[model samples]
Target: MTDERLIADLHNRWVFGWERNAGDDPFDFRRVFGEFYDFDSPDVRLYDDFDPEQRVATTAAGYGSIWEPGFREMISAHHVVDDGPHVVADLGLAASTLVFVARITLPDATTDIRTTSSLVWRRTPDGWRIVREHNSTKVLPAGALDHRLPARRIT
Candidate 1:
């Protein structure tokens, strides 16, 4: 009904699809990508699990390589904090922050990655298209990626 509700729903749908898309047998990346990405333009960008120190762009052929075969299956359990809409002055654009506490199950370990992502949304003729997404993750200690989740702090 409201703008906030719609945005939150979109985000949640993406997360759900991501969790269900990949499996031990084969990774259904097409299904997962179809749910949220805009494949029509080269303007799309996803800073996936990125650290500012290292550059990993999940764009173009890079996406295919990142989710290639032999990669371990991952399960994502996330809760989003909706911060509502923030519009850019005079620009037909708005943005919001979806704070995610994601417990990601890797092949060897499960880590709670506290991520705060800012989604830059624009009202397109088709609907609200995410023009950009910048994700930042909380720093964790070495060997702290297990299920224990001890002394986990959110930044």
Candidate 2:
């Protein structure tokens, strides 16, 4: 398969796993997070919903804290690659935009959040790994997420 296809496939797989995990009783944090990121690379960075302004250096282990347990989360995700997997020497670069609606069910109340993320992937010896990520999220006022778009879903 072509590099672009491979990268797209990888992105879809990760999204599927994320949705699957969200529905699981005991979410498998390591299975998805550990395999998807380049922990060995000291350059990995995250500018996610937690702190959008700060470009925090992150690792596979660090993700455990961010995805904490307590509330149950269910997400419907869509991924779109707007540009190329422009190969630069030994590195392959692909930029993707992901939109996901997460339903968080707590003991008292449930809230739905819509998040848009931009990710920069780097091809590594292991496979494609996320090198940089930025996310923006907002609480949905109403309505369920539309699943009509061509995207990966678990439920």
User: What are the lDDT scores of the predictions, listed in order?
Assistant: 0.52, 0.57
TM for candidate 2 is 0.67
Question: Best-fitting candidate, measured by lDDT?
Answer: 2
Off by over 4 Å in 1: 20-25, 49-53, 56-72, 75-92, 139-155
Range of the 10 consecutive residues with the lowest summed lDDT in candidate 2: 80-89
What are the RMSD figures for all models against the true structure?
6.1, 5.5
TM-score of each: 0.62, 0.67
Which digits, one per residue and each the tens of the lDDT, describe model 2 over residues 1-155?
Answer: 76666665666565556553334566656765676777787877766664433446577556544664531343433333333323222347776665656654443444556667676788778878878777787876543433323333334
Worst 10-residue lDDT window, candidate 1: 81-90
lDDT score, candidate 1, position 28: 56
Model 1's number of clashes is 0
lDDT of 1 at 145: 43
